[model samples]
Target: MRLGLVLSEAGSGLRRNFSMVVSIVLVTFVSLTFVGVAALMQLQIGQMKGFWYDKAQVAVYLCNDAVQNSNCPSAATTDEIAAVKTALSSAPVKTFVKSFRFEDHQLAYTNFKKQFKGNPVADYVTPDILNEAFWVNLNDPNQSAVISEAISGMPGVDAVTDQRRLLDQIFAVLNTASITAATIAALMLVAAALLISTTIRLSAFSRRREIGIMRLVGASNRFIQTPFILEGVLASLIGSVLAAAATIGIVQFFIQGYLQTAQRDINFVTISEAIVVVPILIGAGVVLAAVSANVAISRYLRV
Candidate 1:
């Protein structure tokens, strides 16, 4: 009986301030949607990083006739190559290198031909011009720097390139995008909270006479505030549902339907991942609205 009466009062308040209720709903919807997108973007970035980092290798390229650095005035001799191999097999550097394979000029040339097959550039390239390289796989990708520092500027080495460097640049762009979405979501959430507070204040203002009557009848503050808080919770709940639906649609259509097919190499966030975000959005919306409403109503009742 008590619950029914409180719900009835809440419904009446919602009806009295229909426009404000709608504003809260819309604001909550957009804010939660951004929250969901930012979460999924972060998940996607993590997945990409894990997938790429595992495959990344450090390529230590040796000097050849076509390339001349101050450290390598001429092509690397057989003894210079032997010394590089010994250095890789020796202390400090060897600890980081899980395994190393030397790719000779012939193998490099073959790989280049296969990569640029049927291209005019392939016709002009020769095996002798290609640099020999030690492709080093690391037990931990983060240790690539250790290997590079040890091998770079050596007698026969031209450059020590860690594939992770390129991957870092790509992930940096993705991190920036995720942060932008999160910032927008935070601003929208603040707007939603303010809207909820305003709506509750308006509802309380319209029912000041009723509130005075309840007060005179010895009704508790809890009883007076319950209906108003329920009004905010219900409105925000509706918005959260819409945001969840929108989040699901994005994972289904945009990520799975388009991005997966378009970029087959990349792994995207799935529906299951977005489903995890739905409850979080709903909980956040409900809590924010409830708190905002409670504070707003408490201030109004005190006056």
Candidate 2:
């Protein structure tokens, strides 16, 4: 019976303050959408790090007769190549380099042809012009500097290039974007809280006479407060649902559909991954509205 009464009052309150409720809903929707995007951005960054970090290699470029570089005073001889192999096997550098493979001109040429197949640039390249190099795979891509430092001054080596450095710059940009979205989301949430607080206060003020009569009739404080709290909670919940739906659509239609296809080499976040954020949005909405409603109602509930 009391549940039904509370539900009745809550519904009436919503109808009376419908416009403010709508405002709360829109603000919550936009705020939680930012939260969801922030989550998705974090997931994407992690996935990219996992995928690229595993594949990143530190190339130890060796000298070639066709190329003249300071690191290679003369063309790399068979003995110099042997010396490099021996140095790679030494204890100090072995732990830094997870595994290293030497690619001769023939294999390098084959890879080049496969990479630039049917391109006009491929016609000018010959097997002898390609540098023979040791490709080093590291256990941690962040430790590329260790391997590079150890191998850079070695005989017959031209340069040590870590591909992961370029990836780091890209990820730095993504991190900045995620942080910016979260900051904006926080500001919007503050606005939603204030709006909800004002709405609840107005509803309590307009219904003061009814509340006073109930109090005189021996209504409990919980009973008097339940309806007002529910009003705020319901609005926030509806906003959360809308936000979840919109966030998923953005992830599927725009991110996965367009961006993923355009950058097929990257592994994009799936709909399931984006959906994981829904519960968080719902929880944030419920908590925000409930707290705001109670805070706003305290001063107005005279009894």
Candidate 3:
């Protein structure tokens, strides 16, 4: 009987402040959607790092006739190439290197042609113009800096390039995007909380006479507050469900339908990741609404 009365009062409050309830729902929906997106972005970044870092290699490029710089004053001689080969097999650096393959001029030119197959620049390139390189795969990708420092400034080495450096730039951009989304979500959530509080205050004010009557009848504060809190919780619950649906749509249409097909090489966040985020969003919304409503009602009742 008490539960039914509490539920009935809660429904009455919601209907009385219909516009405010709708506002809370919309605000929470947008805020939780941003939260879900931010989470998925971080997940996508982690997946990319795990996939790319494992395959990244350190490439030590040798001096060629076409390259004339302080690092490569002249084309690398056979003796210089042999010196580089000996250093690779030696200690300190050798232990970190899992395996190394030397690509000669002809092989390098062949790869260049294939990479830039239809490009006009491929026509101007030849075997003699390309630098021979040693592609070293390290046991730990983080040890790339150690290998780079060891091989750099050698007689035949023009440059030591770690593929992870390029990957870092990509990851940096993704991190920035994630931070931006999280920031927006936080601001929206604050707005939603304030809206919920305002809605609760209005509902309490409208029923001040009824509250007084209940107080005279020896009703407890818990009984008076339950209905208002339920009102906030119900509104937030609706918003959370809408946000979950939107999140699923993004994963299905934007991520899987478009990104997976468009960028076949990259792995995107799937529906499973969205499913994981849904519960989190719903919990956050419910908790925020409940707390905001409780605080607002407590303050109103005290006065």
Evaluated with TM-score, which candidate comes out highest? 3
Pairs that collide, model 2: none
Q: lDDT, candidate 1, residue 14?
A: 90
| Backbone clash count, each prediction separately | 0, 0, 0
Instruction: Please provide, for model 3 over 170-243, each residue's C-alpha lDDT reduced to its tens digit, 9 standing for 90 to 100.
Output: 89999999999999999999999999999999999999999999999999999999999999999999999999
Q: Give the alpha carbon lDDT tens digit for every residue of 57-161 in model 2.
A: 999888887878677777788998898888878998788778989999999999999989999999999999999988888877788888777878888888889
Please list the residue runs of candidate 2 whose C-alpha ends up more than 4 Å from where it truly belongs after superposition. Answer: 63-79, 90-96, 103-132, 140-146
- TM-scores for all predictions: 0.87, 0.84, 0.92
Query: What are the Cα lDDT values of the candidates?
Result: 0.93, 0.90, 0.93
Report the poorest 10 consecutive residues by lDDT, candidate 1. Answer: 63-72
Checking candidate 3 for backbone clashes, the offending pairs are none
**Which regions of candidate 1 are displaced past 4 Å?**
77-79, 90-95, 104-131
How many angstroms is residue 258 displaced in model 3 relative to the true structure, after the best TM-score fit?
1.2
Q: What is the lDDT of residue 11 in candidate 2?
A: 100
Candidate 3 weakest ten by summed lDDT? 147-156
What TM-score number comes out for model 1? 0.87
